[model samples]
Target: MKYTEEHEWLRSEGDVVVVGITEHATTQLGDIVFVELPEVGAEVSKDDEVVVIESVKAASDISAPLDGEIVAVNDALADNPSLANEDATGEGWFFKIKPSDASQMDDYMDEDAYKAMID
Candidate 1:
């Protein structure tokens, strides 16, 4: 998995990538109350605002880290917003993307690098 400075996490499974906000981000936001997911088949650009997450403390935009076509969204989050707080990097994942440029992965931080940044 890789991470962006904006606190999104990404993991690839062939051409599709799983995406979510980092646990640190969810922690900072407090308990999640709502999620706005992208529609499947939507085209998105790097840095584009694709999702909205609202928590007890604040609402934040979850931006795309690479240009891609959204292939799946977490329908589970619709009825269970607190999943983000419970498992931000796992069951709480927000979407999946078929990245337009695989090389775009090179731009993100690996787990250690991302952890250090937060440390």
Candidate 2:
């Protein structure tokens, strides 16, 4: 998995890519209370605001790391928002995106680089 300085994480799963916020972001947001996910088949541009995650403290937009069509979303967040707080980089994943240009992944930061940025 790789991450962005903004706390987003990306992982490749065969042809599709998974997107989520890191534990760092969840922690910063305090406690997640609502998640607004994008619709399947919707086109999202790189860095576009595709989702909105709200916590008691604030609401943050989860941007798309690359241009892609939304393939799936994690509706579980609506029922269990705390899942994001408990395991944001894992079970708290936000969505799956089928990137229009796979090469865009090259612009993202690897785990080590991302860690250093946050640290």
Candidate 3:
């Protein structure tokens, strides 16, 4: 998985890419109370606001780090918003998309770079 300066993580699985906020983002946002995901089939550009996560502290936007078409969303988060706090990059993933270009994934920060930004 690769992370972005904005704190989203992208895990490419075959042709689709799974997206979520990093654990660091959840930590900064406090306890997540709700998450809003874009509908399947929506086309998005790089850095577009596609998901909104509401924490007890404030609502945060989760943007697409690459241009893509929304394919699937993590509906589980609707009923389990705290999953973002417990496992931000795992079961708490927000959505998945079929990217316009696979190589765009490399444009985001790697783990080390992301940590440095947060730290």
Each prediction's TM-score versus the true structure: 0.97, 0.96, 0.95
Residue 29 displacement in candidate 1 (angstroms): 0.6
The pairs that clash in candidate 2 are none
lDDT of 2 by residue, 1-119 (tens): 87876789999999899988888888888999999999989999998998988999988888899898999988887679888899887889889999999999998899889888888
Error of 2 at 15 (Å): 0.6
Where in model 2 is the C-alpha error above 4 Å? none
Instruction: Please identify model 1 stretches exceeding 4 Å from their true place.
Output: none
Global lDDT for candidate 3? Answer: 0.89
- Model 1 residue 13 lDDT score: 89
Q: Is candidate 1 or candidate 3 better by lDDT?
A: 1
Summarize candidate 3's per-residue lDDT along 34-119 as a digit string, tens digits.
99889999999998998888999888888888888999998999789999889988899989999999899878888888888988
Pairs that clash in candidate 3: none
lDDT (C-alpha, whole model) for all candidates: 0.93, 0.88, 0.89
Ranking by TM-score: 1, 2, 3
Q: For residues 1-119, what per-residue lDDT tens digits would candidate 1 score against the true structure?
A: 99999999999988899999988999889999999999999999998999999998888898888999999999998789999889998999999999999999999999999999999
Candidate 3 ranges beyond 4 A from true positions: none
Candidate 2 lDDT score at position 60: 84
